[model samples]
Target chain A: MDSKLTTTHPMVTADSQSVSSQEEIVLSVQHVKKKIGKKWIIKDVTFEVKAGEIFGFLGPNGAGKTTTIRMLVNLIRPTEGTINICGYDVTKQPEKALAYVGSIVENPEMYPYLTGWENLEHFARMQPGVDEKRIQEVTEIVRLDERIHDKVSKYSLGMRQRLGIAQALLGRPKLLILDEPTNGLDPKGIRDMRIFIRELASQGMAVFVSSHLLSEIQLLCDRVAIVGRGSVIAVGGVTELVEDTQHLVIWELEPQAQGEQILQSIPSIQVLDLESSNLDNDTAASLRPHSIITATPEEYISTTIATLVQAGIQIHNVRKLSPTLEQLFLGVTEGEFIE
Target chain B: MNSIWPLVQNETIKIIKKKRFYVVLLVLLVLVPMFTYAQMRQAQENRTKFGEDWRVELQQAITDNQNSLGSDRVPEEWKKYRRVFVQQMQYYLENDVNPNEPGGVTFTREFLDNSSSLFIPLLIMTIASDLVSAERTGGTIKMLLTRPIRRWKVLLSKLITLTMFVSLIVVSTFIISYVISGAAFGYSGFNIPVFTGFQPGDTGTDMSSVHAIAQWQFILMQMGLIWFVGLTVGLLAFMVSVLVRSTAASIVIMMAALIAGTILTNMAASWSTAKYLFMVNLGLTNYLSGSPAPIEGMTLPFSLGVLAVWALASVIVSFAVFTKRDVLN
Candidate 1:
């Protein structure tokens, strides 16, 4: 599209130089690959998260999520390709690239013996404009105000995670990369994290969140990249990917005596099974045959129901069920369907 | 530059906060006096056993033994030993000094000089060997590196901290020993002169056997030499720490090197190259004290050069590997 030709903002501008117009592409990772001892840990991964977007990375265990994050932060050198954060190349200009990003790749490790406030102050001193007020603001934002002065060794797991998030926010980074930020949280904590990330996104901070929980990503992310075996298998808007799966139609028909003849008459209908049969002298003799017919959502609503009724079958109910995102995700990712 | 000041301040605070450091100071405080008292007692016992008029006895023996016989009376080996001893006693007696007098600051000075060979060196080694390794063990190394400064700057800060403590240890030894021993002995030896040229094989009876140097100057020179060796050991340990992640391995490797240096000096004397070992170079004072050097033919210049080489090599390796190595999981 011509819109793609619009001038894009560079990740990092020269010192004391201002741009007239700045686009909001916060992070760009292009064909990054990594190998450890002849085994590819990450392969041909390309994605970008615009400013204020919450991008989700979903994968199973040992699916190279950690390896990919490590490479993104310039903690480990990627064997091939480039990553640009805030307009600086991660490989050639790591310090400048890292200046715009804050990350927690695995466990949030801090000096356990130091107080939370002390740790925050120490890390803040590493960045520009990060003074006592900044520390206080970040601590309050992460909900660590009550326990900010206590030693980290005394903090619980939830408290530690909050502190880690607090540390990540100290520099007011343009891009925040969190790996499984809700791994050890309870339901309430998970909800709080979801809300916190959303607020961060609203504030124009691009958040790259990695998690294995499909529901969590579905709730939190604007878009997701489904990774499998060190490669990205799918990347798009959540609803778009889920809506692409084929639709299914089901009909509930009655009459125990004539069910078989009705099914045999409609050559277009593939009978799944007879769900139930009951004979009642007072009301009616009934049979429900659960039938699955392959058709488009519109075609199924019009043609399948009309065909069943025209066959002299009592079509009590007919419905078109759109496949859920979970089913579509499983089907595309696993290539299997549940009957 | 701003980071350097903070880093140095933090290092100093850490050294001050550790109670173990205070314990080290306390041990030195106790041990210095204990050894000083023992040396004082030995001097007192010498006075009592040899009689209060031992100076007169010593002067009369030299005159009587030489008068009873001709000029060539004593054997060569015995004559040489006695000649050096008799000349030392005469120098003391001529200065109206009882070398056996145990109650003076001069006595403390003498005592500290005697103990420098073993006591001060052992204390120096204990602190110096663990300077860098301890941080690695404590997991503070990572915290330090993650700061917005270069890794070499961190090490340089540690080196500066070590030098300050080294100076503190050496100077404190002088002050504490001088004050405590002065209480019993009195502080008169501050200006006394010490002979510096009495090599083991310079001659059978060289005339320059007792060339005098200021007692204070001699002690300072000794301290400077020992500190140089101690710093070499610390730097080498730092290199080993950078190579081997574990603290214990670095310490053991350095300790083994020190012990091996000492052993090679004794057992491998025939191999002249053994003189190049760090242990042989550690005894820089041996050349000044005119004692039989553990390794023969070791000169002050040669020992200093060897130590310089070792220190230079360790520093090179440390800076090269630490800066470039990837900090991976």
Candidate 2:
């Protein structure tokens, strides 16, 4: 607990700075606050997403992540602040602003009664510069060309997701806002979406994605803003923010009583309490009872396992566990502060 | 994107794909045949009774109505309607032209006149109520409003599509009634001289302005007035669709209002203020056929003004609310 606090607290209080300031800023949300009814849902949020980057909007559910994304795409009006996209104000000049933006707020809801191709045509008509060729190109980009002629109701969930991305790319927007893009995807589908998002970013399009899962953002995003209780708690490079909480070693042993006692004698390592951990029960269930999770520096993991084994403990496995964004950014997602 | 035509095209395709207009066509297909069968049966009965003398038939109708006007049991409003019928039949008798000419064109004209108040406007509501609410229910509104076009432009395109379908519905009603009724009643009355331009008032109708025109011209004018009523009702339903979130609810609200209008039109004549309701003023065809208006102080100009005001208010409400309301989940 002492090491976790010392590692993540200073970064949480640090000013949110863009990691890659050299690229063109495609989206700038400045002090955005949204008030629904009498209570303020989003107290204050500010972030800039540059061109050629996957900027992850990281937050827990009800942390106002979706509400903030809505304000960005002009789906919901922000009571107090400005959202500009590619040099255009989203609220004042949504026509010019949204011209450079393509978004799927939740699920991509195309006209189910219309064929996939007809759905493309329906949206293509609303976007300037999107013609038959452009629609065909986007359909190919999402790899939905084979089923483009079928009714969307016949589409599988992954295919519907691909079609959603296909329509978003129809306008050739500079910035794409996807709210929980991988919320309902299979594992392979999620992998393909990450690759697809990276390919778009490499082509100089800015991708702003929001997700409640920190691990998803940790693997996918170049930079992230961690939101908690309707405000941004921290924004920095994903690597820089995750740098402090180094090695997470999973100590598996027989004779767990002797092994745990021997590991507690080491000064450099600290064991994480499974019951006290903020991770939901599913994550906890995956780790067996004989396995003990510990956070320690890289140099001590081998020695800690050696000491456990020398104490006549049978070493079944010495596996290294990577710290989740949940544990790495404890100042933001800590159990006491999250809700 | 600069032009609203693409949006209109999109809406047109949705309406077609959803088969909403097909529903309207099917309703007409089933109803018009039954109407023709009923008319054919009525015509057969009349022929057997009158022995081919429309003059004798007209004189007998006038005597019956005149006798009813003198009866104490006859309501004052019923007596007023009889008085107008008696006057109109007397005019036809003096002119030596049968008002009940049995032909395709005559049947279409008569059908349009009767359908204008309730039938045609109800058909208009089917498409108009589905205009905006379907998007909300189906969750496509999020995509629709996020486009580069202003919100009002999106709504305007829908309004244009609704208008096109409303006009299509009215024109199809005319054609279907004509074609089907023509197959049942022979199609040779287009050149018959028909009298129009009757100025109906509180006490009686003024026939000084009445003049003879071809049966086709009278049908054309009646269609023009009915189209106006259909368009007005379409605008109101469009407003309901904007205000209500579900298409079924929007349709129900409009159906209730239209049914209420029908009931109100049958009500006592003393409810003079009810004329302002757009539903009650939907009978614009009555002025053309020289029938009495439902209430006192109601005339062609008065009904037109009332309908115009209602349509204007609905348009204002639809645009104002649709452009401003939050598209909440």
Candidate 3:
């Protein structure tokens, strides 16, 4: 889906036009640093989230993702540097800077005793110009209208997440920040949240989602920044980050022992043994002993296949492996353990 | 700043919805009636033991105090107390008024005046002690502080809401006490005369300061005075709530201080400095009722000044800590 496409909904479109102008930056962090006691929690972090985009913040555990987010939301002050939201400095004028921002820091915790509608209404009262109609609209947008009257304690985790989003969406915020928005969601709930967040971005709201779930972030975010050890290691479009690098090409051939020896003779080809048995018995028997081979230039796949076939080994299948976000993350972080 | 009103309104709603307030109301609901019933039974026994003539009873009480004054075994403090009692008893006897009347308004006024020192403070602390800390535990403080409002404004709104609720609880206590006790003891005595300003001086009762006021007027003044003390207690608890992260700790600390204050007021006469403690001055109603100050040389103005300083310091510290501290979960 093209998340950049403008929706036909009048309210959303009007909001999009008024608040988001294509490339306008909604959130900017410049050389932000945070120190707690003697240790640096966030070290020289800097990034920007543009209008009409889902910007994913990916990091290993204890990598300062939450610390950066807290500074952006003004829950804690940065020891150094400035954060501007919609042109207002967060430290100097937090009330004005945060006026256009809505966020769920870690969990969408609310008053468990209060009903979902009451929670929305309570937060709505915190911001100006958020009336009953806007509350209803956001509630419907989250598909929580049917259960909005129930107490938050009774709502499932997925429902609580939706209600939290509804609360943030009140006042039609220009920037919606969700720290681990889908932390405790089921597969269907995660999918629903991904689509809903994209829909929010399409309506012109900039979303900053921080998560350890690389696959979800890969599918949901238009742009992503990976942070490791208190610093951002990579930032760009997901497709560009994954596709801009060299990858392996696996060539499956018949009579694997003969095919391996044939490919071994070629100086350009590198054959890696299968580390573990991943193939099912039926595919293994039907395919009749195929081995894996890699071409260094990747474009040499045709030559490697031709060379193998000429040596009397029948080529059964040829597959090119594209890098996934997980692979890219592991590669960039040097296989660092992610929590 | 323009959103302070809505913020205050929201806070008020949040407080009222908590089950703690209902628990407070329930305690009051059961407590006042039981107290009034005991008072009624005591009054009945008094009538049965000493005939129905309040004048005769007043004369006998004065004679007994006069007799005690002649005894050398009485402590100097009791001698001073007996001297004031004799003078006040004579005044009541001359005026043909019964000071201890078994009626709704009379019991309420007396109950509030007596309990202001401890019970009322305890109830107000229940609501105030959790004002900020409960939000932290429930994780709602993040939601509240992250809004497009200043932290001071948010804390100020909570303070204002606490002031409002303290007033509400005080008024409700009176109303609930009156209604429940009135059912048992007839709702009369609104116009009954109650005397004030019988100060205990170095020698005897300070007759020059004595005066008389109706029971309703006395109750109103008592309510106003107790409300001030309650607000002071609430403010102190508010500061503790901000400083401490747990609701139970805040309430316990405040309660411990108050309970210690009551004990100190009786025994800390020698300490002298104990009179300056904030909790010591919480009995503001004592001044209106013309009761002797708990400590020597501690007058109404002195107590008020001490309480004012405490309240001011609490406000400043609470705001300073809350606005600057990092809200880590």
Candidate 1 lDDT over B46-81, as tens digits, reads 667667786766676567554534456555444444
Candidate 1 docking category? Answer: incorrect
* Candidate 2 structure, TM-score to reference: 0.91
Predicted structure with the largest lDDT when compared to the true one:
2
TM-score comparison, 1 vs 3, better candidate: 3
Residue A291 of candidate 2: its Cα lDDT?
84
RMSD to the true structure for each prediction, in A, is 9.6, 4.1, 6.1
lDDT of 2 by residue, A202-273 (tens): 998989999988779988998888788888877777776676555567777888877887777788877778
Candidate 3 runs further than 4 Å off: A1-20, A244-330, A333-339, B59-87
Model 3, B1-329: lDDT tens digits are: 37589999888888877776897899898898889889988878778878887666677778988998999998766676678778887877777788876789888988998889899999999889999999998888888988888999999999999999889889999999999889888889899999988777776668786789999999998898888899999999999999999999998999999999998877676688888899889888887766667788888788888988999999999999999988777
lDDT for A153 (candidate 2): 92
Q: Which portions of model 2 show Cα errors greater than 4 Å?
A: A1-22, A245-275, A287-329, A333-336
State which candidate has the highest TM-score: 2
Ranking by DockQ: 2, 3, 1
Q: For residue A62, what is the lDDT in candidate 2?
A: 82
What are the Cα lDDT values of the candidates?
0.67, 0.85, 0.82
User: Candidates 2 and 3: which is better by lDDT?
Assistant: 2
